[model samples]
Target: MNPIDTDPPPPTACFTYGSLMCEDIMAAVCGAHAAYRPATLQGHRRHAVVGVAYPGMVPNADHRVQGVLYLELPDSAWPRLDAFEGEEYERRIVTVETDGGAHAQAWTYVFRPRFAHRLAPADWDFDHFLRVGKARFMADYVGFDTLQPR
Candidate 1:
């Protein structure tokens, strides 16, 4: 009997904002067949702050955060992703606008301000996040510590 047989598959719609935005991480976290779509959430911004379990931190605000929306993933993978994120972040229903101008309601993680703070950078460094910080930061979602340096 193989342990692989006991574990289920991954989820279909797993959104990636940080390191997971990179194709390689996505493939590793989810699976080969997972497809990612460029999507945006209106009135929400991504910030780097308050270091915790994951890497840095991700907190939402009135500003918008640009990210890639993953397709629905297998249910089996949800637990791993959820555990990686932890309790500070809560899964919520959100509307994501795709490049095609279609709005779809999906689940996303949000950090509580009472436990954390807002990200102060004028804009989030998506490229930098994709390259070095995403994977480390996204392992856990915490409130913002401060803004990214200019």
Candidate 2:
């Protein structure tokens, strides 16, 4: 008889669109660099969250959001990322397209339905974030430690 093969599923890939797309943020969160590639998530619109600098994605058949696809993250890393995201967003499986015409499945954060009131009507601009908001976000952000269940 063939040997039984039993193992938990491997760690997952993550797709990041806003502040988490910054190497500085991910490195700080996970305590190391995570590999990533440029990819686009279709059929969703990313909007600015009310009273905050971060962005949130909502389903829109005609829209698309471009971001980095971080590959094969250790399951150990998800908690910190989750804490950093807080309850405002939920991780969901999404299909992304790379420039080479390849498609992939990765986990991306989406705005929680209960938190829908936080989304702004206008689309979020990553350029504006890189130009102005990114610095403030880096300086003032508290780590996931504070957010861990107490």
93-150 per-residue lDDT for model 2 (tens digits) = 8889987879988888899889998898999888998998888777678654344521
State the lDDT of candidate 1 residue by residue for 1-150, as single tens digits. 797778543224655565556676555544345667998887666656444212223444656767778776666455555554456566666778888999877667776655455444445576766566665654543322221211
TM-score of each: 0.66, 0.87
* lDDT against the true structure, each candidate: 0.59, 0.82
The most accurate candidate by lDDT is 2
Q: State candidate 2's TM-score.
A: 0.87
* CA deviation > 4 Å runs, candidate 2: 1-11, 144-150
Ten-residue stretch with the least lDDT total in model 2: 141-150
Candidate 2 lDDT for residue 37: 87
Check candidate 2 and list the clashing pairs.
none
